[model samples]
Each structure stands twice: as structure tokens, then as C-alpha cells.
Target chain A: MSGGRDRGPDRGRRRGHSLHAFRAILAKDLRVELRTLQSVPAMALFGVTTFVLFRYGLDRTKLSGGLAAGVLLATVLFAAILAINRLFVAERDEGGFDAIRLAPVDGTALGGAKAAALIVYLVVLEAITLPVFALFFLDSWAGLAPVAGVLALADVGLAATGVLVSAIAANSRARDLLVPLVLLPLLIPVMIAAANAAEPLLAAQGPAYGGIGKWVGVLALYDMTFIAVGFAVYDFLLED
Target chain B: MKVPSLRALSIATILCLGAGFTLVFFYAPLDADQGFVQKIFYLHVPLAICSLAGFMIAGVHAIRHLRSGDPVHDARSYVSIHLSVIFGVGVLLTGSIWAHASWGRWWVWDEPTLVSFLIVFLLYATYYPLRYAIEDRDRQARYASVFAITAGAFVPLNFLAVRMAQSLVHPRVFATTSGGLPGSMLFTFLVCLAGMALLWTCLVCFELAAKSASAKLSRLRRALEGETYAAPNRSRIAPSVPSRAASPLT
Candidate 1:
């Protein structure tokens, strides 16, 4: 994005630089996150704490099937909501939107970067919290691999939809409240797909991968749909 | 580019709905399984279909609004969603009644269609807060359009996901009701569906026309009574349609 600084009347030619702009924004977001540690640590802590709460709330030290999947995904989803709400705060507060508007770079680069950044946050969050959940609840780690797969697909969908919603809610009053209210309903499909897919894998006896393909397909469809919609509409959202 | 007059639309709505209810009671055969309670199906199914269609139509209008930067399209989009949400209320109420009658429960998470409708309704119900949260008129409309389009796309996917999540224990409602409806039942259902669709359209027209009149009245007040003469109780969240003499709503 900084390379746009010297462009003049030939700025229209810079349209080809969206990928570079996307990378720059992604790098900047990562660098800021690494320095400040605002989102990931909080999300990880929230996820872990949620597991502890669920352990007590459900009164189940050893969960399996749909109950286990529900407990795990619900924690992950709410934590992701925390990350999503914070995704666009820096831009909103520091005049980053004006900077993007003035830059010759494509506006959608911001959305792409934010989503990528969210996916990173979710991955790091899952990495930390999923282990804690397993240690606290599960008797075996055999299903962890496919459970991770479900979580991975769900993270992509969540990130895409989250970033899109974050952009919208970031500009409104009571934005914090708006994000979850508008977003939770939207994320139901993701929850359904992920939970159902993870259930059989999280079964009490052993992990079974049956019927996982279709749910994975649903998650993939959800990711692509939101990513495309977010890309298409981010231009309008940023148009002041 | 003229819309039917509100009175004419209202008449159509009444005629269709009246004929539909009459057909439901007088013509359609009683269900072998669910005798009288099955009648709610005629009302609930049509409302659900119309409400879902209205949401998708709002998405189309939202697309046009974004492309044209026209408040008229935004108005249409808003009214479409707004009226559909009202229809959604009817859907839920009647659906609950049907469920209570059939399953002996007021609600059933096992039923994919009912659950999915609830999800869609909850999502669109947030539209009001989303619009009110944004103080900027132009920004509010634009963001709401973005939301409308996103939620519209979500409707079908939600149904698919929820349906897949349904367990095998609860047989599908249609399957239980029998795979095919008899001729008389199907005819009655078609009339009710048409009636509900017309009612939705009439409501949209009614809302848009009311909004247009309010806009025009405010514009006239501004012109005659000076800029400082602000009307009390003017809604802050409602998108104000530009008062053009030849507006399609008029």
C-alpha cells in the first residue's frame, strides 16, 4: 500500500497491485497484533475459560457426541466473536479508513487482510484452547485430528463472515452489541455444519469419519459465499 | 414504472384471502392423519414462502440500491424486509399452532423448516437495530443493503444446514403428511399461496405509499414553514424517500 505514495495520474494502472496491497495490510495487521497482543491472548483466555465453565455447567468431566461438540464449538465461536469485534477497531479509531480511501490501492485489500488476520487469530486461539478442552474433557485424543479439520473449516467460514460483519458493525453505535446480534444468526449454518460433523468424530467409543464430507462441503460453501460477498460489498462499505 | 394504487392492491388482497380461506374450509379434504389442525398448513406454508421470497426480493433491491445510489431502491428494500418480517410473525405464530396441534409441542427443533425460519426471522429482526444504530442516512441505507444481501444469501444455506442436522427419528413433515396431496387439497393450497403472496405485495405497497406521503408532507412543510420548522415525532431511523412528483410509489 505504501508504494501508492508516488503514483500520480497513472494511478489507474495501480489496479494490478491489489495483491501487494493485500499483503501489506495483512503484514501491518499481524505486526500490530504481535506488538499489542490485543486479540489473540484475550480470545485464547476466553476460550479456555469457557471450557472450564462448560465443564462445570454441563457437569460432565467426560463429554462425547453432540454435547461435547456443542461445548467446544460454542466456546470457539464466542471467542471468535471477540476477535471479530476488535478486527476493525484500529482502522475506525486511527483514521485508517481515510488512509485507505486516499491510497491508490483497491479497497477490498483491507477486507482480504482483515479476514486473513481473523483466520490467524482463530487458528492461534484453537491451537491454545482446543488442547485445554481435550485435557479437561476428553478421554482420548484419537478424534482430535478430524475435530481439528472441522474446526479449521469452521474458522475460515467464521473469519469471512466475521470480517464482513465487523466492517458493518464497526461504523455503527453500540457496535459491540450489534456484532453478535447480527452475526450469531448468520453463523448458525457454520455452527450446524461444524457441530454435526464433529459429533461422530467425538463419539464416546472412537472417532468415525462417516458423513463428514457433506458437512465439510457445507462449510466450504459457506466460506466461499461469504468471502465473495465480503469482497463484492467491501467497496461500497468503504465508499464514505 | 407505476405501482398499483394502494386501494386496488388492498381489494385484491381481500378477495384472494377471502376466497382462499373459503376454499380451505369448504373445498379442501380433511387430512386423514391430522384432520382439523392440518388447516393451519394452508396459512403457515404460504406465509413462510412469501416471507422468504420477500427477503430475496429485498436482496435484489439492495443490489440495485448499491449500483444506483438511489434511496428509492433502498426504500423498496427496507419496505420489503419490513413487511416480510411481519409476515414472518404470522408464519411463526401459525407454525407454532400447527406444531402444538400435531406434535403436542409449541416448538420443535427437530423440524428443519420451522427452525430455519426462526433463524432467518431472528437475523432479519436485527435489521431494525442495524439501521437505527447507524446515524448517517446514506451510510445506514448502504449498510442495511449489505446486510440484506448477506442475510438473503444466508436463507437457503441455513435451511440446507439445518435440514441436514435433523435426526432420522423425526420423520419429515411432508413425508408424514403423505408424499402427495389430493387434487382438492392441492388446489386449495395454491389459492392460499396466491392469497398470501398478494397480501405481502399489498402490505409492501401500503408501507411505501405511506412513507411517500410522509416524505411529501414533510417536504411541503419545509417549503412553506421555513427550514427551522421541524416536525415533532419525525422518525430518525426510517429512510426518508425523496419527494419527487412522479415517484413510482405515488
Candidate 2:
């Protein structure tokens, strides 16, 4: 560990090394997830099943433009909800929150770490779902690249919001129901931007990059705002 | 200085709203485009603006509650959101009426403002359930404040994103044919806006007073009878007013 490498300044700065705490939490979550196979696989499987349901429900062999964007975004959003609903369960069950509070580290680290973990889960879910979406509904792959950018920004927004909401719902009585009820409305703007941006790229003729930048900018703004807010208010949520 | 009594504010709200309605019907000229249907605009827009403002005010109160650790701020935040959600119903109903009268549809997704309000209303409607699901009083207040702040920030961004999504395809429907509001319409709109704002304030004050009175009565009952007479009930979704109900304004 780097704890002993710099003994002088590091000793004085130990409490402020929230980054170290954040990394430890993130690593712990990732390790547990890897071993348990808890969230990612379920999200990916849910995404695939939703795509199949869309095929049967919409009664379309293939989809394009706004319809395609809506279907894909909604599917991915539900999958994200599946992941988010479970994000804080381990912490609540195992008394991880008390441990975090007792440690000499910034409380926001838990929020940051949880958000990062959710982002990782989302990325993995997308890796599996995007290909299936293309194979099932997309007429061309040209738009997929730009759509990836939209997805990334949207994922950050989703993770930041999901982690905060999950934390709030964790100690509540109806934890499972409270998460989705509170989370969906908060994610509407992200879904709006992602769907609008993807609509052009997923057009039947070919991908168009014309208006994608504006929507991506909206997504980025939403991400930054929620991340800052989550960071600022998370400590209040943690205080016993 | 003494705060203006709730009775005074309620009377002022009545006068302003009455005068605003008269101006809408008799003073302002009918629009060349939509004629009588456009009248709903006077009611709809003001309600929308007031409701959104109420949500933001709740957010401010939530910030205070979180910072000061005061239950009064939480009560204020809860009441503000409660009133705003009621106003939100007005916005949606009036909006639907306008849509039906203008476009022959009961609901129109093409109107970005209405759609955005719908999204926001749905979001805030969950606030009660969220509060109910939390059993601890203090924790519920804190979490509700967090929700309020987050949802408040979401209001403008949601409007912007929804507007952008619609702008590329649909021309905005609520604008006057003259490209800018004429003097008479603008005056009438301003009056209605003021009236709605006043009504919102009056209702918030009334609710606060009612809640304060209820809390004091409960305290009095406990004082005269005993603790067992006013036993602590099961947790409620509404925020509990602290026993210090002396300052309803806070």
C-alpha cells in the first residue's frame, strides 16, 4: 500500500484522502460483484428479454428512427433500474454505512464509489445490449458509434442519480418499490436527450450527426449537475 | 413588524383573481387565431408558472432544513410541495382543455410545456410515497429534503430537454400571432400571474396556520390530559410539526 511511502505529508492528509476511500469502496464493490455475479448479468439478460418483447409487442421485424431510439432507451433504462435497485442492498444489510461513518474519510466517497460502480454496471450492460439491438432492429451500424457517446454521458447521469436515490431508499421500508418510483422521473431528462440523440443515428437511411451534438450537450449538463448535487448532499443523507 | 394575517392575504387573492378574470373576458381583445379557446391561456400559464415556483421554493426550504436541522423548515417544505402539487393538477386540467379546444385532442404531446409539466407532476407525486415508505421521522424529513432538492434542480433541465426535443419538429403553439404580446394581453397576463402568485402564497399561509393550530391543540390536549391521552401514533406520511409551533411564519 502507498500508506507508508510518504509518511510525513500523508500522515497529516490521511483524513482528506477521500480518493483513497473512494477507490477502496469502488474496488470492494467491483470485487463483490465479480464474485457474486449479482447485477450485471441480470441487467444484460433483462435487456435481451426486453428487446425480444419489443419485437413481439411492436410487431415490427425492424425499427428505425424515433421508434428505435425509444425502444432501445426504454429497454436500457429498465435494465439500469434493475441494477440501481440493488446498488445499495449490500451496504444496508451488512451495516456498511456505519463502518463508513466511523472511518476517518469523507462521507461523499461512498456516494462517489456507488455511482462509479453503477456506471461500470451500465457499461457492461450496454456492451451486451447494443449489439443485440443492432442485430434485432437497426438497419445500419453507422449510427452506433455516435450513439455510444450519447450512452456514455447518459450512463453517468443515470449512475449519479441512481446512487443517490438508492441511498435514500436503502433504509426505507419499501426499498424495492421506492427506488424505481423515485428514480424514473429523475431520469426523464437523460432519457429524453439519449433518445433524441440516438434517433438521428438510428435513422433507417443512414446515420446523421446533425443534431446529435446538442442532445449530447444536454446529457453532459445533466450528468455534471446531478454529480455535483449528489456529492454535495450525500453527507446529509449519511449523517446518523 | 406584524406579518399580514392570512385573512388579509386571502381577501387580496380573491380581488386580484376576480379582477384578472374580468380583464381576461371584457378588456383583452379576442385573438384572431383561436378566439375564445385562447382564454384558457390566462388560467393555464399562470398556474404552471406558480406551481413551478412553488416547487423551487420548497427546494429552498429543504436546503434550509438540511443546513439548520430545523423541523420548521421541513414543515414549510412539505406544505409548499403539497400546495404545488395541487396547482400542478390545475395546470394539467387547463392544459388539457386548451388542447381539446384548440387541437380537437384531449391531450397533445406536441406541446412541450404541458408534457414537461406532466413529467414533473409525476415526479413529485412520488414524493408522498417516498415519505410514507420511510419510518423514521427525522430520516424521512432528511431524505424528503434530498428528494426535494434533486427534483427542484430537475425542473428547469427537464423543461429544457423536453423543449429541445419538440422544437426540431413542432412550432411552438402558445405564442401570439403578433410574434410579441400586445399591450392589453400583456397587462391581463401580468395581472393573472400576480393573482395566481398571491393565491399560492395565501394558500401556503393558510395551510401553515391550520397545521400550527392543529399542533398547538394537540400539545394543549397533552398538557391538560396526559401523555397517554395523546399517545404517539404510528408514523405518518405528512411531516410532523415540532412542538415549537409559536412561529408559523418560519
Candidate 3:
């Protein structure tokens, strides 16, 4: 009776894909990470350096650099592109993608792991970029709070969307050029939101970029919309 | 398999196109504000809306193809979206000219209608590169269909995003929040919208015929190639798309 139940389609669950399969994918990716340890450090170094250049580029320093914060989400986003551009390349290059697809892994689960890994990678970079900018330019406590929140939210959306694109690029020819070209245009809106919302915070002006309520709502909407899309579409993308 | 004829459609299109313009010139009262040139709104706004509708149809077919995996639906959808791009180009041109005429500038960074179309233009322009990159017939269809479906998000997101970015310069004369258009203007606007929509249908049907024919021709050509497919072509055709066609435009 136990064997029959365990082997049943119902017990197998949802077209034979299992949560264990999802967990296995997460574990597989982590094991791979433990072996290489290359991507995270490269992404972190690139993200930190890019953030510093922008904050340092400003002349008048304090107030001016603050104003630049909201707008320079584009720069951080470019750093994201650089970091994750090779995301699925390793899977394709080593011919491991096929084995993974054949491993009973749900596409969403696999995408979730990669996205989780990328977010972890990007957040480390952000951990470097944001603090360096904070010590150098961001001074006020009130301003710092919202700016940090918005930036964190913006990075999630960027990474999720970027991961899907990176998959498409990795599969195609002239992949390196293709990824960034497609990515940067899509990144423009998030850059707009991040910049506009963070502007007042940077400048210590009244937070009136459509009010904090409207501004953060846009970022949240963007995050939910893209993450859902990335998860659903990643299956089709990853299925060879 | 079957599509409706364009006969009555085009006749109605021509008649209404004439009638729509006539009302714009003769019937609608002059604005209490901008005088003669304001009449361009009758033509400009409807055309933009018509193109937006075209984009929406393309997006719908894109989703249908992705879900159902039917090549026929994919062809139809690709046709609808292709026509949308053609119509969208027209919208940008006419609207920009009118903008230049009124505002003394060809482009405004803060205009909702203008910038929104710019984003749409950029988005659809990439559609070609997307098509060229993938080799699978059905996968190409699937990817394109999904991209098109996802584009609906861009239309609204761009519109809303642009509005949030700055104080919009484009007039909201038609917006209900701005008290709506006067009755005569409203009537002319609706007629114009109907006329443009009819014209769009005709164009989409035309392009649908062209695409379906082209696809059949390519399949027939491949079949004619007969032996070996040059040996390399068979495997190459399965996955690696023609590299040049797939490159990003910049």
C-alpha cells in the first residue's frame, strides 16, 4: 500500500516534478558554487568599483553626489549586466545543461536557484556599492532609510529580469553583445524609477518624486511582475 | 485556415476615412484655445490609439501561439504585430510632426504620448533580432509569441512610467479627469477611431496573407533542397541560427 501510494502519479505530484527535484537543483547549484567560487567574487569586485567611480566622479562631493544617487541606478544596472552576462554560458559551455534538464528538475525551481544565486551575488556587490556611497555621500538618517530600501528593491527586479535575458543570450550566437544590447534598454525604466525616487533623498530635499508612496509602488510592481515572469518562462528557456 | 475578404472592409474604410476627416474640418467646433492646428488632434490621437490597438492584438496572438503551440496562430499573430509596427511608425511620424508644429520641438522628453510611443518603437524594433536568433520553427514562434504577449506590459508600463518620471507636457484633453472633450469633438474622435481601426484590419489581413505565403515558400524551398541539406545545414538548422541576422542592432 505504501509503495503503491508513493509510485502513484498523484503522489509523484504535478506531472512527476517534485519539491525534492527543486531542492536537488538548489543543492546542485550550491555544490557547483562551492567548487568554483569564481562568479561571486568577480561580481562583487565589479559592482563595488562601478559604484565608487560614480560617487567619486561628482565634483562638489556631498550634495551633488547625493543628487546623482537616484539617477545612477543605470550604472549599478550596467554592473549587474557585467556580472551576470555569462550566467548560463557555463551551463552551455560544459554541456551540463542537458543533464540538468533531464534530472527531473522543474524549470521554475532551477530558475529560482539561479535567481537566488544571482541575487546573492548581486547583493554582495550592492553591499559594497551602497555602503561606499553612504559613507562618501549619504549623510542624513531620514534620507538614507528610503534610499537604501528603494535601491534594494530595484536590484531584485534588475537581477530577475537580467537572468531571463542572460539565458536567452547564452543560447544565441554573438551572445555577449546580444545580452547587453537587449538588457540596457529594458533597464531604463527601473533606472528612471530608482533615480527619481532617490533624488530627493540624495539631495535632502522633500521626498516629492511622486511622493514616496507612488514611487516605491512602481518599484514593487516591477519586482513582482518580472520575478513571476522569470520563474514561469525559465522552464521554456531552460528546456534546451 | 480561412480569413474574411477585404472587399467591403476597404470600401467602408475609404468612406469613413473621408467622413472622419470631413467632420474634423467642418463639424467640430474650434477649440476655445489653440485654433486651426488643434484639428490635428482629430487625426493624430485616433491614429495613435489605432496603432496601440494593433499592438494589443499582436500581443494577444503572441500569447495564444505560446500557449497552444499552433503554427497557424503564430503566423496570424506575427502578421497582426507586423502590421502594428507599420501603423506605429505612422503614429510616431504624424504625432511628432504635430508636436513640432505646436510645441516648436520635434521631441519632448516629458510628453506621455510621445515618449510612450518611443519606448514601443524601441521594443518592437528588437522583435526582428529576436526572430533571427532562434532556429526552431515552433520555438521561434513560441519565443516571439511570448515576447509579444509581454509587450502589452510595456505599453501600459511605458505610459505610466513616463507620466511618473516628469510633469507631462502632452495635453490630457481627452482624459475624463480633465473633463472630457466637447460633444462635437467627441463624435469626430469616435468616427476617426472606427475608420482607423478598419484601415488597420485591412493592413493586417494583407500582411497575414504575405507572411503565410512566405512561410509556405520557405518550407517548399527546404523540401526542394533534397539531398544532404549540405550535410551541415540539417544540424545547423536545428539550433544555431544564422549568426549575422541575430546580432543586436546596438
Candidate 4:
């Protein structure tokens, strides 16, 4: 299989550097997402519906402090899971994974590209959902700024883990069920840090800034750790 | 490969456990705070530590499996996580008993270690399902290793996050009670920890031996009766022994 490409000149050319491949894959995913409107819009809609459910579920028109933080975090988390579940469906159904495997480009690029795409979906989901969340529950908007920072860091951690897990689940027999079952437990630390950070920011008194830095540090640590792990293990995962 | 001396290990485990229990009940002084109920701590904490160590050790074996492409390492990793999960159940049960005795409740989120342990247990409990969801054996083993490594790394971070979340409110329950332990209590605790570690090792070896024996029996049956007598296995949750390791006669 490697005979034709064993020549020196063709080797470098065939094994095109990962940056180009990464960008190509990321752009392709974005274009498909844009044209299809498959994941982001549905996730946004889910977020809004969940918020309304929480409104009646909690039986409170207004929410603040830990309750508001918990509801908002949980809503975003479930929405992210929806997008994550769909992240690799196209690649699996269509022959995207096989194509990437055949290519000489590094396999980690697929992980990187998929993670980048998931991050975009999360950002868009937050954009649509956070405003609705604030209007529905928050007494004031003072907390929104710091909470956005926390959410953004949390999004990175979510993207790193979601992309890796989505790839693993996509190839499994019970792909749909396996994604959520395995992913939720892995996400507890992220949820813990995000909720803890957002709790004070969404407080009833007027948005305290205390300890946001520590929680953000934890989020960043989790993000970096999983991103490195996903990159290191991506090659092993790709082997037939 | 030569099998380790399971008999000696079992004897050591029994002796250490017996001595540890004697120290707990007879020699060590009762806690001024928790009184007789504090005895459960010696059991719960050691099991908790051993289980966590077992998980990290599984991650190490998984790394070896991936690097060497050796199914023996995979078998070792699987058995380690299996034993750890069993120990995790013990930790949760004993922990619940301690919580009920002290706080009058079966479960409490305020106890960071117990809560973190519950989360860890929930995470590892999915390992069997994850393994079963993959149809291919080689792929199943590889994916399971990846899961083990990821979950292993998550253990410490999960504990840290949970501890941080609870730090502000919960007054470090374990620390306050065991901070300045008397010399006898400390010695007894150390002995119990050693005993629990030995028990974990003995159980892992015992399970591995049983699996190896079953694999060898199947191999013998295949050799004697040809292909027709060998039936396909229906259950996918149990990790398979590498064929080479299973057949000593070969």
C-alpha cells in the first residue's frame, strides 16, 4: 500500500502538514453546519424550551444566586450535549473518517478541527440562550459580564472533551445512548467549576466577583489537560 | 509466564487484616468525638485509598498496553479496574454507614470525599457498558483502555473540584476528626491501610487466575473436539485473556 508513496519527493507532498488539513477540515465542518443548520439551531431551540420548562418546574418567575446559576449551567450543558451528539454523525454516516484515515495528514487534526467546530457551536448556543436566561431569571445584568468569561472557559473544556468522546461514541454500536451516558460523568468537574464560578456572579445581592478567578483557573486546567490527552490518544483511536 | 504465589499473598492479607482488627477493637483508644462510630473510618478510608490507587495503576497498565500492543497488559488493566470498582462499592457502603451514624443521614453532599467518591464510582460503573458497546474485540480493548486512562486522570481533578466547591461551607469533616490522631490510632490506621492494599492485590490475582483457567479450558476443548465444539460467547462485558497467555500448553 505504501509503495507508490515511498519515493522521497512524494512523501512530503503526500504527508501535507497538519495546519492546512486542520483548517480544511474545520472550514468544511463550518460550511456544512451553516448550510444544513443541523446542530446549532436545534441546540438553541432546546435551550429555550428547557428554560421555559425550568420556569414552570421551579414555579418561580425570578431566580438568582445558586438556583439561577444551576439552571443556566444545566440548560447550557444539555444543549451542548445535543450539539456534541451530532458532532460526528455526519463523519460517521458519510465516509469522512475513512477519508481522513487514508490521508497522510496527522489524525490529531481531525480531533482539533472537530473540537474547534464544537466550540463555535457552543458560542453560538450561548449567544442565543444567555440573553433569554437573563431576561427570564436574573434580577440584573451586572453579573453577565463575568459569567460570560466563565462560560467561555467552560466552553473550551466542554469542546475538548465533547469532541474526543463524540469520536469514540460515533464508532460504537449504541452510539446515541453511549454518548450521553459516558460524557455526563466526565463532565462533572467542568459543571462543578462553571456552576461554582457562576453562583456568586448570579447572586441576589448584585453579582460578587469573589473566587471567579480560582474557578476559571480550574476550568482552564481541565481544558488544557483534556486537550492534551485527546491529542495524544487520537492516533491510537484512529488505528484500525 | 509464571504465576505469582497467591497462597502467600492470601495468608499475608488474612494475617494483616486480623492484626488490624485486633488493634482497632482492643488497643486503639476510642475517639472523644465520634466514639465507637469512628471505628468505621479505619475501614472506609483505607478502602477508599486502595481503590483510587488501583485506578491509577490501571491507567499505567493501559499506557503499557497501548505502547506495547500486548494483551497481557490489557488483561492486567482490566482486572485492576474491575477490582477497584468492587472496592469502590465497599467504600460507598462503609461511607454511607459512617455518614448515617454521624450525621443521621444515609447520604450527605457536604462530605466532599464521599461525594467525590460517588461521582468517581458512577464514572467507572459505565466502563462495562462502554466495553460492551463496541463489537470488535481488539477495538473494544483499545477503547476501554482509552476510557480507563481518561477516567483515571479525571479522578484527582474531580476530587479537587468537589473539594473546592465544598470548602467554603463544609468544615472538612475528616480532617477535624483525624487531625492530631494519638500514636496508637495512627499505627492502627497504617496497619489497616497495609491490609487493605494486600487484599486488593490478592483479589486481583485471584480473578486473573480464574479468567486464565477458563480461557485455557476453552482452548483445550477446542483442541480436542475441533472447531465444532467451540461455541461463540454471548457476553461481551468480560475482558478476554490474550490467547497466548491463556494457553500454557502451547
lDDT of each: 0.88, 0.88, 0.68, 0.86
| 3 or 4, greater by DockQ | 4
Candidate 1 has a DockQ of 0.86
lDDT of 1 by residue, A1-240 (tens): 335566663465576577788899999999999999999999998998888888888888899999999999999999999999999999999999999989877789899899999998898998898888889989889999889988999999998889888999999998899999999999999999999899999999999888889999999999889888887788888988
Q: Write the per-residue lDDT of candidate 1 for residues B121-237, one digit (tens) a residue.
A: 999999999999999999999999999989988999999999888865333445645647777888888999999988888777767777778888887898999979888686777
State the weakest 10-residue window (summed lDDT) of model 2 chain B.
Answer: B167-176
Q: Candidate 4's C-alpha lDDT?
A: 0.86
Query: What docking tier does model 2 reach?
Result: high
Residue pairs in steric clash, candidate 3?
A70-A195
**Number of the top TM-score candidate:** 1
After aligning candidate 4 to the native by TM-score, how far in Å is the CA of B92 from where it should be? 0.7
TM-score-sorted candidate list, best first: 1, 4, 2, 3
**Per-candidate TM-score against the hidden true structure:** 0.94, 0.93, 0.84, 0.93
Decide which is better by TM-score, 1 or 4. 1
lDDT of 2 by residue, A18-48 (tens): 8899999999999999999989999999999
Candidate 2 clashing pairs, residues 3+ apart or interchain: none
Q: Count of backbone clashes for each model?
A: 0, 0, 1, 0
Give the higher-lDDT candidate: 2 or 3. 2
Off by over 4 Å in 4: A1-16, B1-4, B168-179, B232-234, B243-250
DockQ of each: 0.86, 0.83, 0.43, 0.84
Residue lDDT tens for model 4, A102-179: 988888988899999999999999988999999988889999988888999999999988887788888898888888
